[model samples]
Target: MRNILILLTAASIAACNQSSSTMNEYKWPADVKPPIAGKEPKEFIAHGDKRIDEYYWLNQREDQKVLDYLKAENTYLDTMMSGTSNLREKLYTEMKSRIKEKDESVPYKDNGYWYYSRYEEGKQYPIFCRKKETLDAPEEIMLDQNKMAEGFKYYSIGGTAVSDNNELLAFTVDSVSRRLYGLQIKNLVTGVIYPETITNVEDNDIAWAADNKTIFYVKKDITTLLGYQVWRHELGTDPAKDVLVFEEKDNRYYIGVYRTKSKKYVGIYSNMNQVSSEFRLLEANHPAGEFTIFEPRKENFQYSIEHFNNKFYVLTDWEAPNFRLMETPEASTAKENWKEVLPHRKDVYISGMVVFKNHLVLSEMKDALNQLRVINQTDHKDYYIPFSETVFAAFQNVNPDYNTNILRFSYTSMTTPRSIYDFNMDTQQRELKKQQEVLGGFKQEDYTAERLWATARDGAKVPLSLVYKKGLKKDGSNPLLLYAYGSYGYSVAPGFNSNIISLLDRGFVYAIAHVRGGQEMGRQWYDQGHLFNKKNTFYDFIDCGEYLIKEQYTSTAHLYANGGSAGGLLMGGIVNFRPDLWHGVVADVPFVDVLTTMSDPSIPLTTGEYKEWGNPADSAEYFYMRSYSPYDNVEKKAYPNMLITTGLHDSQVQYFEPAKWVARLRELNTSNNKLLFKINMDVGHGGASGRFDYLKDKAWQYAFFLALEGKLE
Candidate 1:
């Protein structure tokens, strides 16, 4: 689930002059001890069951004791792993070497400007710039994020919208990493920023009202951080005077505003429990007009709209579980009036679509692989854009223009660096605009990428994407890292990752388990792994690990598991289900307190996630979740070495969840194995804001695995 607060890779460590040794051989300070949290038991009685939480007191973020405990844990980790400082630095340098220090994104044309972002040679942030009319024109600096980020410890720029006249730029920024962005406007022509600012706006939810002065943005609830209200604000006016255009009374729905590619209408989208959605549309020309409901909300009904020509195209799951494309006249925008444009197929899932003057491109998924189907509007003829790699990811890119025959998309695989291309629908030709330049001496042929299938315990075939240096032998001796995020119907793509190259080059096999709970194999795949069948996700991941061991790709002595957020939940569950199967595990910002989180609607994502993980207020659902909850299932048994990470200000899964889970695991674990926790006091769910800074966290993780593998030098 993309919406689930998942941790993106980021980290850093101080330089130390120390000799590195393997975990088993490294000397530890005799007096150094792990910080033990003083527990105060709190009991919750629900559904005729009582759960005693010993570390519930850690939830107090404002408490000095909680902060001290987190700091102590960090200090303890630094002391225990201090010997691997050199190894971490080496890994960080190696990984950073692969990235081009100064790079620019492919310029995309929108409105009358060719807009793109580029980083300076040594800058930590990008500078957004544009050229008027043509690429050859003089560059116009819209926003220099590098300059804006100078004074803040953490800064992020969210959605940026250029008015229809291309003179005013509306953007959102988050300085504290809580994802509560503040909306601001800049006059590109005058080089002056507007004084009026809107606070607590949703990230990437701002849309210009064709009038240029008026804009629509979603306001987030101060407590839950849920974007529930849509507001209309006019330039030069105080934001406090803004009108509340729409308010979603249902706590189950998350709302956002976006403009159509054709610039015809602005829409307010309401996503209901990730299972259904509703949209309100208004003409972009009428800023003060009320938005009419395109379609009322329905249970289990999902649809998305695209405007082109004179009709509205909808990608809907009304009668198709895998979804299909339909078209409805602009005057009649109801489900009954919708006519099928592309019929549904059991084998293929219509994931997304893009509208243009002469072509309609559909992003479809089949057998866990992505494909782009292009259709000719005149003749209704369709064909797929071919990809040579057996396991790769290809998806639509920035194509905001509606009258162009060219389509932009990105393609990448485990071995292939991400490449951008512009395909001409009329000529059946493609031009490679740019391919990521790996600064290090990296070659595609030096590594091997292959797709393997593992049969789950229930006989379902789960796919695994593997990548390693060439000449990897199936001897069950090589160290392997398996990753997955099997929730929210979000499919993990087999895309190229420059950071993983550091692991691959170090004789480590990197693989992604396309397990259940994700829509890798289509909608049914996700349905089977969520709610009552959620355990299927855990079972499938464990089955993949067992199959890998059985096939000699790796063994219990050398196999490791890694995941963040929901995937982190997978890491926790797998270790409990089969602790002896893994040598070490890294759970990043994991959501382990499942029953407690789902039972409390006050949590950020709790109310909206009832459909994903059943409402735990019910007896059956409560018991089911408790049965597998990592924090609840900790037992007095030998467990694998683990490193858990969390952020102080994470909005997704609160830091307290991991903090509490770790405290419980320490109480019950019977093994002498290390259980280290590293909490970043500065950043939120996603670690560092800078590109290179995030690699430090990656390096920290790699060093942990290398130390366990005795590969540290």
Candidate 2:
């Protein structure tokens, strides 16, 4: 069941550090510490008699994405040949036993009504909470997943959102496509989807104009990499109601979208040779055609066009590596007309910006700790929102009906599940939502979030987040699972995950290492950890393991590391770079071979993120990527127990990467054995079926964790 860890000339726990008692300074070979333990460390985990490519077919999905490879081979591997039966069958067989059925008696999260979607037979279908009795009832309409799998009509929505006058109900039904979709409309009290014309027109995102008459959404032309066109659709009896916006020739550049706050349109369009942005005022009364362009910066990169305070605000790296923002009057023109408000002073990318009634809100990060700041539109001054040092937080939406100056957001860290709060602008009083209560019959007071530092190879301190039961001392006595993802600009925020409750209730401690690659700290934090900085992510992860030991949060023998997708890379890197520090490892759909993976540009995020991870064609970048790639780094030596998982249909991080990495590892490492692998026959990158299917995945990982290290009786 496990891909026993290969023996390696692995770097000892001491080689990773300089302390005299540290494991060892040099990398040790696998044969040096053969995996002789009955923990089954020496067995190869591959499915014997099964060709690697055979699993490819069972798991292979003929998504349009794989067309390029199939065409190159002059083969038509379309649905006509493979179909989706195998996938559905695999999911039904693998996931049915893993999760509890959607029994109406079993309650779900309090966010909505917990019941089964009888419409769908096997899926843990979305439950419809249609009381509509109170205003506070489930208002955020539509679960994106439900819409994706079950279609628009059958899915359910939470929370109700009535227009300013309650004349129209602006509800969104979330559906899945290549991306999650929102089926939106102003209900005329008909229990059916309206505007038959709009219904036939396929569009994932649907945001209503303030007047509720016009709709704003992007029309994606998937011919090229970035061929999304922003369109404005007027909801009336007229058949030809929708119109092309920005009407530009370059499909990649003519990306227009409606901004919620200012109720205006923003997008980066090209003018002659220079690429810039255009802002348009879009309300029910004010139609398209009357548009305005603002702030013509010389340089061209990714910039955000937003409407705030009845004006336009542009956040772009036109002048710096990071984002700097500026605002213009009602119709400020050109680059010179712009006045800088928030300068791009540091390294982190801008996560989000919000405008409250009285205060213009800004959430920045030294790394990724939502550093809240408020700019009084009245006084034109910036004031830091008062809050303690916390990582991964945000300013929630505002209640439009109430004129009260207030804001809301949820914040948390390694140990904290989530503490949602409503902050009043005038009174500065905070109201807690749900009060950080622990579910699945557990106690919150039992766990704590520890903000510790793990210095990387260059002495830069990487942050580590730890959550353990209150009674557990820093004696390194309990099993520890350190999780992290250090790729792209994806910030691993400090919020609560209810599913994690499963692991927490078991007396096992959970720690999230906010290493360098994450925006947890800020811009500089990510820069130091991306591309050529990639090794920093791995080293930072290793340092986190070492820090946990030094802090006595856990011992080397009880420590484990895990990550998925990009984070899966984190799992592989930590194991390869410093295998001795971890007692076990799990890599899910890992991109362990960076150079090889990156060379293949057809991957979903690969093209755009080439800017983040260097182009391997460049010798320097290739050398750097290879230095940390887990697949290339795998050496014959003593290593820890491990689990590797992948979905045959995974289009993002291909299943082949993880499969190959594990195979190579099993063949190479002769360590203490205990290596494992699981490839879901039906799934894709997520490799999950339904709700229960996903949970079963979690349970399997957790079961392995408890068996290997929880020291269960």
RMSD of each: 4.5, 11.4
**Candidate 2, residue 218: how far the Cα is off, in Å:** 3.1
Give the alpha-carbon lDDT of every model: 0.90, 0.55
lDDT of 1: 0.90
In candidate 1, what are the lDDT values of residues 207-309, reduced to their tens digit?
Answer: 9999989999999987888999999999999898999999999898889999999898999999975499999999999989999999998999999999877
Name the Cα RMSD for model 2.
Answer: 11.4
**Model 2, global lDDT:** 0.55
What tens digits encode model 2's per-residue C-alpha lDDT throughout 369-447? 6666667677876666666545445545443312346666665655555566777765667776544444334555666
Q: Judge candidate 1 at residue 510 and give its lDDT.
A: 95
Model 1: lDDT of residue 600: 88
TM-score (C-alpha, index-matched) for candidate 2: 0.71
Best by TM-score: 1
Candidate 2 segments exceeding 4 Å error = 1-188, 194-204, 209-216, 219-227, 231-256, 266-302, 316-325, 342-350, 381-383, 388-394, 398-404, 413-417, 498-507, 686-693, 710-713
